[model samples]
Target: MVFKCQEDSFLKQFKTTIVSCDFATLDWVADDDNRNNGETRQLRGFNVICEDTILFPEGGGQPCDYGTINGHQVRSVQRKGSTAVHFVESPGSFEEGSEVQQQLDWSRRLDHMQQHSGQHLITALFDREFKYDTTSWNLGQSVSHIQLSTPHLISRESLDLIERQANDLIREGREVSVVLVDPATALEFQDARAPRGLPKDHEGLARVVRIAGIESNMCCGTHVTNLSQLQCIKLLYAEKVKTNVHVHFVVGERALRKLGEVFQREQQLTAALKGGASQHLELVQKLQQNVKSTRKSFQLLLKDFATAEAERLEELPKAQRPKYFALHRRDGIEVDFINTLLRNAPEDILYFLTVSEGVAAGSSAKGHMVLRGDPAVVQEMGPKFLELLEGKGNGKENNFQGKINNLAKIEECTALLEAHYKPKKAATAVEPASAS
Candidate 1:
């Protein structure tokens, strides 16, 4: 069925009757699913079918339109057969055959129109100039990309050419019109770039959207009436994914908004780097080089400190030396420091050493640890130490090492090690004292 949205894309308000309303439940997820932190809600609502609506159902790489029905919020609308099913978020039901007011979200509709029409223009230009067919396209939240059939990568020169031609056509202000023709005669007006056939559930005449002096394509999505409404077009870049190349671009208000955002970021970078935009790259490169040199010097200093610590332990007299030694650093992930210390130290005293990332250990702070000395003690303590740190590792003979995260419990682990190696005193007999 030809939807009202397809008939008149500019229509923002329409009066329609509710054909049916059924109990329904929707599992709604956050719009930014990646950063939602595993949050989801079950939306109890009604599946409302309206006789006619300005709300467009999702189709042709375009998302569904969001709006309201009789003052209740409708978040989703989908096509079921020839009808538009509106998912109204409400516990109350809409009476069947009752009159209702349908409202369209104008900003969303305008944005979709700009993007969809821009895709049509771009597709036509690529087919005309490069003989490359558009296999598919994606209307992204920020930018849109069209998958070109060619395997050869598009160069910067080609991107500039296409972008220039697209804006020129937009400047020309060409008229865009839609025509409904008989299914049998549809092929006569549409160009070779048109889709092969109509949708499976398509009824009545086929709709073909035509750009003046350009091309005609079989499309059901809404679009702008004139090319000038697009404002501008900017072809960003192209990327090759396996077999096809995706050419990314922005259209109309999106291009303007993107420009503003980029300029704002540039101002922030200038303040942080203490340089103008022209010198930002050079300053960043120099900063990176300096950091590299400093890191190398710091690593050498850590090794020297490790060697000195080991030498101090070795200088202790045999009788005066403790059975075990524990050292912890609250600065970094310094496994090399632990290895260097063990290399220069005596093998008799059990050693427990750790280096964590923060000054004060939090539950999430990460670190590395090593236990060395007696093979028997190493094997016994390896698994226990991992369990205490909420980590994992394995050991064979004289050393056990692993990565750990829960550093807040390090004191408890140290106490456990201390109690294990504490010296025992000799027992005394009292029989001679009793006789005296």
Candidate 2:
């Protein structure tokens, strides 16, 4: 028995006997696996390097398949030109020439197939319908894009028209045709050309899939046999990038599910916010007013609060000032805490603020506070200052902030400043005029 396939179609099924075999399995797996966390496969399954397999590993910026085959986990799949190989996660070996049952992960493949096919149809609309050539494309897992060769601001009307035409072809159930021809004969279609990303050795014959009369391009990734194989499609997002429109799209079952999810979420949000399933705009206005009023009130409270905190922390001695840097939670204190304290202090004292890692997750922990004051008078209640707190924090410096496991440090930060630097101290200190 003999089976035949197109030169490019050989990745799917071919009965041609192997003319040669060598150790071409990628050894770079160990390096890649190590970089992606610590997942390493211990499979000893037969490493089958076939001339044909439908699996297109993540190459050319496309994601790889994630499914099982024949009960063995084919963890990695790679394709080079027309040849594809499947790396199984097992220890058993299959002879090279063995005729065995083969199957593909259809659910996963069908998704990509439709997406890839849809890209061609849409791309054709740009060229045939608008005379713009696709400059670049990225057929991602969820969305496919095309970069038009010319810069033209595509209006929403243009987008809608193209999308409508593509869907119409899919609805029509047009039979897709895959044809192979020698390179010399391939150049005969002067206007027709293969899609981007084909092997450079085009001197040999190549495989091209044509969508009925809609579109044609080179592709090794699995694609729908007919337009009907691709169900409905929805254009999710489209943004203009210089001369091109960066489109994110969805097709078939996934598109439907996504639309349903969006509508459902919208309805729920309307009900929760506006007391009905449709009063969203009214509710949004009400929310805006409430937020504005609350912000005004918060500003008043914060002004008074920060003033009181600043005044109360003005005059504490170096060792006596508890790690007050945490006062930064009040916003203004972040960079200003040290400066504010220094302003009211005698010049002999140097105010310092330090930050370190916090309890678990936070922007950062404002660690300790230290005031370099007269050493003769300085005594460290400082290290013991943080010892009384919650998490671990100690300092040879003037201040520290830990878990604040101990809240007692708060009293230390505020009291010395409040007791020593009375407001009277500031108003009364007038410097004598220097003799000129």
> Best candidate per TM-score, number?
1
Give the TM-score comparing model 1 with the true structure, all chains together. 0.89
lDDT of 2 by residue, 9-112 (tens): 22432242322233323332442323645454454544455544445565433555544434555566655444545666544555566544444555665676
Instruction: Please provide TM-scores, in order, for all candidate models, with all chains considered together.
Output: 0.89, 0.66
Compared with the true structure, what per-residue lDDT tens digits does model 1 show for residues 1-436? 8899999999999999989999998886645523665478788899999998899999888988888998888878898878999999987999998999999989888988999999999999998899988989999878999999889999999989988998998999999999887767656455525554667787887778889999988887899999999999999999998989999999999999999999999999999999999999999999999999997887788798889877977897777676777777765787888889889987778888878875444355778888887898889887888888887777789889898878778777767776776663211111122112
Among the numbered candidates, top lDDT falls to 1
How many pairs in model 2 have backbone atoms within 3 A of each other, for residues 3 or more apart or on separate chains, i.e. clashes?
A: 18
Error of 2 at 223 (Å): 2.2
Ten contiguous residues minimizing lDDT sum, candidate 1: 426-435
